[model samples]
Each structure stands twice: as structure tokens, then as C-alpha cells.
Target chain A: MTFTGLVGRVFMLPLRLIINTCVRLRIHPNTLTFIGVLINIAAAWALALGKFVTAGLIMVVANIFDFIDGKVAVELGEVSQFGGFWDSVIDRFSDLSLFIGLIYLYSQLGRTDYVMITALAMMFAIMTSYTRARAESIIKKCKVGFMERPERIVLFMIGAFTNRMAAVMWVILVLSVFTVADRIILTYRELRDARQVAA
Target chain B: MKRAASLPARVLWNAFYWTYERATWQYDLMVIAILAFVWLTPPDWLNDPMASGCGPLGWVLAQLR
Candidate 1:
């Protein structure tokens, strides 16, 4: 493996340990995943209150739990269809809540310009994931895009920590929308090709 | 059942496979990093019209002011 992959694997060691512990204790991965979602929602709510640093810290903690859940599932051999589905569903909600909180914050601050951008960012963020999900429903492949969930989370963390609300919103809006469009076009071509081959 | 793959088909398949193998992980990570940086650092120039040189968007906002 490359150095980066090695690093990623190393970073995941603690998560694997947690997963093993959970498995030994008979704790379900889905339960941990649900708890992670709850933590994330609470973080988003905190962000809405302008507790940016607190929100950022909470998000980091929640995401660690999120990572652990996957490892736990693997260790416990409890990876289920519903587990993946619920995780994804909650993830979307978590993503949306962050931007929604920001929008509410900007609105309360009377920052109209920033408000629209924040709303747009939230919309685009949802659309980005939606495009990928929709495409997967039709195509067998997941199209890689410029912006993905990890990137979005990083952006939000940066914004929270730096107090760069408006800039973050603008970046998310532009990049997420672009990613959505790119995925849609990719899916359309793939599906069309598949149809042509069948015909 | 005996049809041969066309040149375009072969080329496209190879290209897709190459891209899938080579770029997916790194590209996704890079995009994520860019988003993180932008979000974390809202440029001061964005909020300051004078600093931003009254660019098109800034100029328009200035008109409203």
C-alpha cells in the first residue's frame, strides 16, 4: 500500500479496537451509528447557536463514532442491508442540519446575502448526494465527484473553527452544485450506454 | 451473441477502468480538502469591497449601498 493508505489504515486502528470491543460486548453497529447521528444533530444545533468551536469539536467526536460503527460492523459481522440504509439516511439528515443551522444563524444576524448562499449551499449539498444515490440506482458504478461527504465535513469544520461562515457557504454552494451536475451527466451517459448495448 | 466490441467501446471501457482505479480515491480526497479549506477560511476580501477591488458582485452590492 502507498504511504497515505498505510496512514489511513493506521488511523483506523483505534476504530477497529472499538469495533472489536463492541462485538465482544454484543453491541449492535446500528445502535452506535444511531448514536453518532444523534451526536451530529446535537452538534449542528450547537452551531446554529453560534457555538462554532463547540460544534466543530462535537462534530469531530461524532465522526469518530461514525467511523467506529463501520469497524464495529465488520468485526461483529453484523453488516446488514438496513444498517447501511439507516446510516446513509441519517447521514443525509446530519449534513442538512449543519447547513440549516448556519442559515438560521445568518438570518438571525440579518446577513441576507450570506443567508441565501448558506441556503444554496445546503440545497446543493443535498443534491450532490442525491445525484450519486440516484445514479447508483440506475448504474452499477458510483461516479466519483469533486466534492464528497468527507470534503463537506472538512469544510464545515473549517468554517466552524475559523468563523468564516460566508466563505464556507459560498464554497459549498459552488462546489457541491458542480459535483451534483457532474454526477448527473455521468450517470446519464452510463445508463444510455447500457440501454444501447441491450438494444 | 458473437458480436465484437467496437473501438470506441473498448477505448471507453479502458478509460473508465483507468480513471476508476487511478483517480477515484485521490480526487475525492482532494475535493474534500478544497471544500474544507474554503469553508474554514472565508477570505477577508470577500466582505471588503475595497479589498476585493469592487469586482462585479461587489460593485453591484456597492450600488445597493
Candidate 2:
């Protein structure tokens, strides 16, 4: 296995325990997804207050639920289209809340430039994920992007912790916009090749 | 399935697969580390421009100036 795969699995160990407990308690995965949103709401509030450290820490814990819900759903054989849809919807909300908090913070500081940057970053981030999902509907898979969720979340948290907000937002915006373009091109090729073969 | 990809395409495809499936997460953690390092180390020249340059980052910092 790749080292990252090993690390990822190790990271998931504690989560597996929680998933077990969740199964024992008959807790629904959808409920867990909703709880994740609530935790992120707190993180957003922290961000708006410029409590970067608190928001960073809160985000770390909150996002764990993202992994746990999916694993629990799969382990319990409860995976469903609705469950996936709900997870994606909640994730977008979480993404938006972070940007909105930043926008509010910048507004208060009267940094109109940062406000626009945050808004642009947020829009491109959503588009990056959207392109992948829309492409997946028409192709086998659409993981052809550099700014996937893990990167975006990790970079944002690092930016928060280090107080390099501008650098992080710029990186996210550039990479996410590039990712959206990459998905479009990848999807086009896949569809085109499929058509050529069918003819 | 269509015929196998040509050798160059195969090599490129494998490289992309390795990046997406295997190396990207580890690389992401490394990037986080690197960004932190850049912020912490703060060579004077880099910091100066970063604090008041023309880009989005500089513009944000300029608000505080």
C-alpha cells in the first residue's frame, strides 16, 4: 500500500471505533452528517470573530464526521443515493460558511479587497467540486483535480492557523479554478472517446 | 475496451494515477508543512513583498498597514 494510504487507514482507526459505537447506538449516518454541519457552524462563527486558532481546531474535529459517516454507512450497508446527496449538500454548506465568515471578518476590518478575494475563492471552490460531481454522472470517475476536498480543507486550516489568509485563499482560488477546467476537459475527452467507439 | 494506450500515453496515464490515488494526500500534508515553514521562517525579502505587494495577499496585508 502507498504510505498515504497507510496513514489514511491509521487515521481512520479511531473513527472506526466511533463508527462501531454509532452502530451499537443505532445512530443514523444522516444524523451524523447533520451534526457535522452544526459543528462547522460553530467553526464559522469562530472564523467571523477572527478566532483562527479556534476555528482551525474546530474544523479538524468537525471534518472527522465527514469520514465517519461514510465509513459507518458502508460498514452498516446503509449506503444510499440520498445519503451521498445529503453529504455533498452539507459539505457545500460547510464550505460556504467558512468563506462567509471570512467575508464578514474582512468587511469588519474594511478590507474590501479581501472580501472580494474570499467571495471569489468561495465561488471557485464550489465550482471545483460541482464539476467533478457533474462529470461523474457522465463518466466513470472524475478525480482529475489538484484541489480536491482534502487539499482545500487542509490548506484552509493551515492558513487559518498560520494567519496567512491571503496566501491560502489565493492558492485555493487558483487551484480550484484550474481543477474545474481540468474536469471539464477530462469529461469532454471521455465522452468524445466513448462516442467514437460507438460509431 | 479500446486498444491499450500507446507507451507515452501509458506512462503519462500511470503518472497521473499515481498522483491522484497514491501520492496526493501525502503531498498535501507536505504542502501544509511547507506553507507553515514559509510563514515561520520569513526571510526579510519575502516577508516585505508579501506584506505590501500588489496581489490579493498584499492587498489584504495593506489593509492593516
Candidate 3:
């Protein structure tokens, strides 16, 4: 096995057991997804309260749930378009909540600049996902960006834990905007090529 | 005017599709990084609302505060 594969196997051993138990409980993956978002709401609450460490730790646990739902879905053969659609919708909400928390804290701190930047980051972050979804509507596959959701979550986690949110906002803003642009260009090219070939 | 895929277009396509294929693994690495950073960073350091102890981040936060 490759190094990451080996590591994933080792790490997932426990998660696999948890998922098996979750499956036995007959819990829907969507339920797990819902639970994860609720936990993330708690994380956002922590952030708004200026409890950075608390927020970070809670976010860590919350994302572990985020990862688990997929495994549970795959293991139980519950993967469906509806399931995926709901998960994506919920994920956007989850991302927004976290950014809202950060914005709240920034506003409280009277960092109007950071607050605006954070708002911009949140908007572009949503656009990052939106561009892909919209592109996928017309193209075969629209997975063309580096600043996708999971990376944004990780970057936010880093900023929260390390108290480097300014750095996080800058990264999110630049990369998310770039990602949106990348998707637009990629989809445009793909459609144009398709039209040319058909013609 | 229509032509074959240019070198730059081909390069971009390959790079993006390659990235797409390995996106899961990349996400895994980022998760590991976040967890490791959280574990290593002291609670006090992380809990500093104003980031008063970090380097540039702290300086920026201090200015904002």
C-alpha cells in the first residue's frame, strides 16, 4: 500500500468500527450529517464567544463526524443523489456558520476591515462551491479547483487553533476567488470545445 | 476558429484532473495538519482571543484591538 493508504487504513480502523456500529443502529447518513452541522453550530458559538481553543477542539470533533457520514453511507450502501445533494447543501450552511462566527468576533473586536474581509471570504467561499455545482450542471465533471470545501475547512481550523485568522482570511479570499475563476474558465472552455466539435 | 488543444490547455487540463483524482488524499493531509497543529499549539496560545502571542497574526490582531 502507499504511505497515505497505509496511514488511512490505520486511522480508519477505529472509524470503521464506529461506522459499523452506526450502521447497526440503522441511523441514516443524513442524520449524521445533521448532527455534524449542529455540532459545528456549537463550534461557531464558541468562536463567537471568543473561546478560540474551545471552538477549535469542537470543530475538530465536528469534522470527524463530517467524515464519518460518508463512510457510513458507503458502508451501508445508502449513497443516493438526495443524500449527496442534502450533504452538499448542509455543508454550505456549515461553512457559512463558521464564517458567521468569525465575522461576529471580528465585528465585536471592531476590526471593520477584517470583518469586511471575512464577509468577502464567506461570499467567495460560497461562490467556490457554487461555481463547481453550476459548472457540473453543464459539464461532465467540474472538480477543477484547489480551494474546495475541505481545504477551506482545514485552513479555518488552522487559523482558529493557531490564532492566525488574518492569515486564514487572506488565503481564503485569494484562493477562493481564484478557484471560482478557474471553474468559470474551465467550464467555458469545455462547453466551447463541445460546441465546436458538434458543429 | 477551432484547433486542437494547445500545450497550455493540455497542461492545465492534466494538472486539474490530476488534482481532482487526488483531492481526497489532499483533504486527508490537510485534516492531519489541522489536528497536529491543534494538538501542538498550547491551549493558552490558541485561546488568546486577540492572538496576542502569535507573530504577524498577533500584531495584526493587536492593531485591530
Fnat of all models, as shown: 0.15, 0.10, 0.13
Alpha-carbon lDDT of model 2: 0.77
For residue A125, what is the lDDT in candidate 3? 96
**Candidate rank order under DockQ:** 3, 2, 1
Model 1, span B1-65: residue lDDT tens: 11587887875443333233323565445545555555333255566111224334455566799
lDDT of 1 by residue, A1-199 (tens): 5444565678678766766777789888888888888889888898778898999999988887777777788777888899889888888888888888877777777778777877888888888888878888888876655567876886788778866656666677877776776777678778888899999
Clashing residue pairs, backbone N/CA/C < 3 A, model 3: none
Model 1 bad stretches (over 4 Å): A1-10, B1-42, B48-65
Identify the runs in model 3 with alpha carbons over 4 angstroms from their true place. Answer: A1-10, B1-49, B53-65
Model 1: lDDT equals: 0.72
lDDT of each: 0.72, 0.77, 0.78
- Look at candidate 1 and give me any clashing residue pairs: A151-B32, A155-B36, A158-B40, A159-B40
| Chain B TM, cand. 2 | 0.29
Using lDDT, rank the candidates from best to worst. 3, 2, 1
Rate residue B18 of model 2 by lDDT.
Answer: 28
**What's the true lDDT of residue B18 in model 3?**
31
The positional error of residue A166 in candidate 1, measured at the CA in angstroms, is 2.7
Task: Output the worst ten-in-a-row residue range by lDDT, candidate 1 chain A.
Answer: A1-10
What DockQ would you assign to candidate 2?
0.15
